[model samples]
Target: MKLDDIKPDIVHDVTGTYCPVPIAETAKQIKEMEIGQILELIADDPGVVEDIPAWCSSTGQEFLGMYEEDGEYHLFVKKVKELT
Candidate 1:
């Protein structure tokens, strides 16, 4: 499915936050989500452009894609497994 067409099961907005905050929040939120669920993380930190995908890779989740608008980034991640 297209990234634009993917409806997220949940959304976490960290617009003013930076670096680890965005990634940390994503980790915490994903832990509560079920497998196959999608997370839309709204962030203004440019670090997420690399951090999100790297985090997803290390965590084994699916890094769907990302898009930027109005100086903000909207990243999509799909839960593919459980986290302890």
Candidate 2:
């Protein structure tokens, strides 16, 4: 299924947060969720440029994709099985 089609079981809006903290929290949420779950992260922190991708790489979660809508950057990830 497409990234958007996968309903994120967990939604995290860390717009005001900064650095790796927000992305780390997103990863943490994913870790605590059930296998094959989805996590939708909406982060405004520019650090998300590196944080999100880094988190995905380290956790092995599927980094489906990210896009900008209106004035927000939306990141979509699927837990798919487990964090490899």
Q: What is the TM-score of each candidate against the true structure?
A: 0.96, 0.80
Clash tally, candidates in order: 0, 0
Q: Write the per-residue lDDT of candidate 1 for residues 40-66, one digit (tens) a residue.
A: 999999999999999999989999999
TM-score of 1: 0.96
lDDT of each: 0.95, 0.76
- How does candidate 2 fare on TM-score? 0.80
Worst 10 residues of 1 by lDDT: 1-10
Runs of candidate 2 with Cα error greater than 4 angstroms are 81-84
Pull out the clashing pairs in model 2.
Answer: none
Candidate 2 lDDT, 19-58, residue by residue in tens:
7678778868887888777778887877776777777877
Which 10 consecutive positions of candidate 2 have the poorest summed lDDT? 75-84
| Count: clashes, candidate 2 | 0
The candidate scoring highest on TM-score is 1
Model 1: colliding residue pairs: none
